[model samples]
Target: MIGRLNHVAIVVPDLEEGARVYRSTLGAKVSEAVDLPDHGVTTVFVELPNTKIELLHPHGEGSPIAKFLESNPSGGMHHVCYEVDDIIAARDKLESDGMRVLGDGEPKIGAHGKPVLFLHPKDFMGTLVELEQV
Candidate 1:
């Protein structure tokens, strides 16, 4: 069961600039930086009243953000993350329904160390879907 919209990830060329915009300009309280080495991403958080936004950039070649930036250096919206109660079950259903999983298989830890899995955009009308176990 998906709980709610957890966060929207936006790839950026500069993490500091992104933070300044989302924090000072938007009045969002920024959180600590989160490094997901496995995914090759360095993420920073912006806490909001209702939800949060994650500013992302590639930390290495393995990052999806790297590929995203290569195609469009200006960066763009990466994906939307939804909170889920049971990621395993959700992944199973999506898999059985023929959703393409981005990673090899199984859920992996995300920015906040929560179990996360991504559904290929081809399965969601070009919108990448991410499920995070809350």
Candidate 2:
């Protein structure tokens, strides 16, 4: 089962500009950009009182984010991550309930260095859902 809201990911065409908007305009505390080659994204986390906002940029031509940006040129909300006590259990439960998991149905190390899984967007009302182990 899902736990607390982990973070909301937003795809951006420019990672630096996205971080700048959060840091300067919104006056938020932004973390340094980190390149996640496995995930094919360069990310910046905007810290907040309750949760974090993740700004993601495509890291390579084959990056999924690159494909997403091609469809949504200006970039947009990519996914909502929720915490889970046990990612495998959550994945099994969701699978049994008829929800489709993405990417070979295995957990991958996420930005927080926690195991994570992504569910199909169509199953979750057109919104991509990410489940991260807490």
Candidate 3:
């Protein structure tokens, strides 16, 4: 069902500052902030093999990102996204295993047009998991 660790998302107060730190301090090659209006965020992606570090800042106070930042003071590890060959199959597997998905039906489009679904953190021992079809 799951393929690889895709990315660890981080909610940041400043996207630019986060990108600078990841690039200059950690020596990561950072991408220009990618505005995902549909998701209500401006994200900077630090590409890594089979995984990445996504720096996210809220587009506005009403955005979900803002609430996430408010909930987790450290703003680290908002979600652990997994890469899968088949997101639909992954969702089915999770459901059959008695996991509660955060949706009613079909999965939705995610970053970069990838199909994605969220398996409730309550079901995975408090780890918010995102399954993405790449």
| lDDT values, one for every candidate | 0.87, 0.92, 0.84
lDDT of 3 by residue, 1-134 (tens): 57788899889877888999999999988999988888888999998765799998887447767878888766777899988998777877888888888978488898769888888899888999988898
Q: Give all candidate RMSDs, comma-separated.
A: 1.5, 1.0, 1.5
Can you write out model 2's per-residue Cα lDDT over 1-134, one digit (the tens) per residue? 67799999999988889999999999999999999888888999999999999999988668878888989888899999999999999999999999999999999898778998999999999999999998
Q: Tens-digit lDDT track for model 1 on 57-82?
A: 88866776788888879879989999
Off by over 4 Å in 1: none
lDDT of 3 at 9: 89
Pick by TM-score: which candidate is best?
2
Question: What is the Å distance of residue 95 in model 2 from its true position?
Answer: 0.9
What is the descending TM-score order?
Answer: 2, 3, 1
Q: What is residue 88's positional error in candidate 3, in angstroms?
A: 1.6
Between candidates 1 and 3, name the one with more favorable lDDT: 1
Query: TM-scores for all candidates?
Result: 0.90, 0.95, 0.92
At residue 103, candidate 2 shows an lDDT of: 95
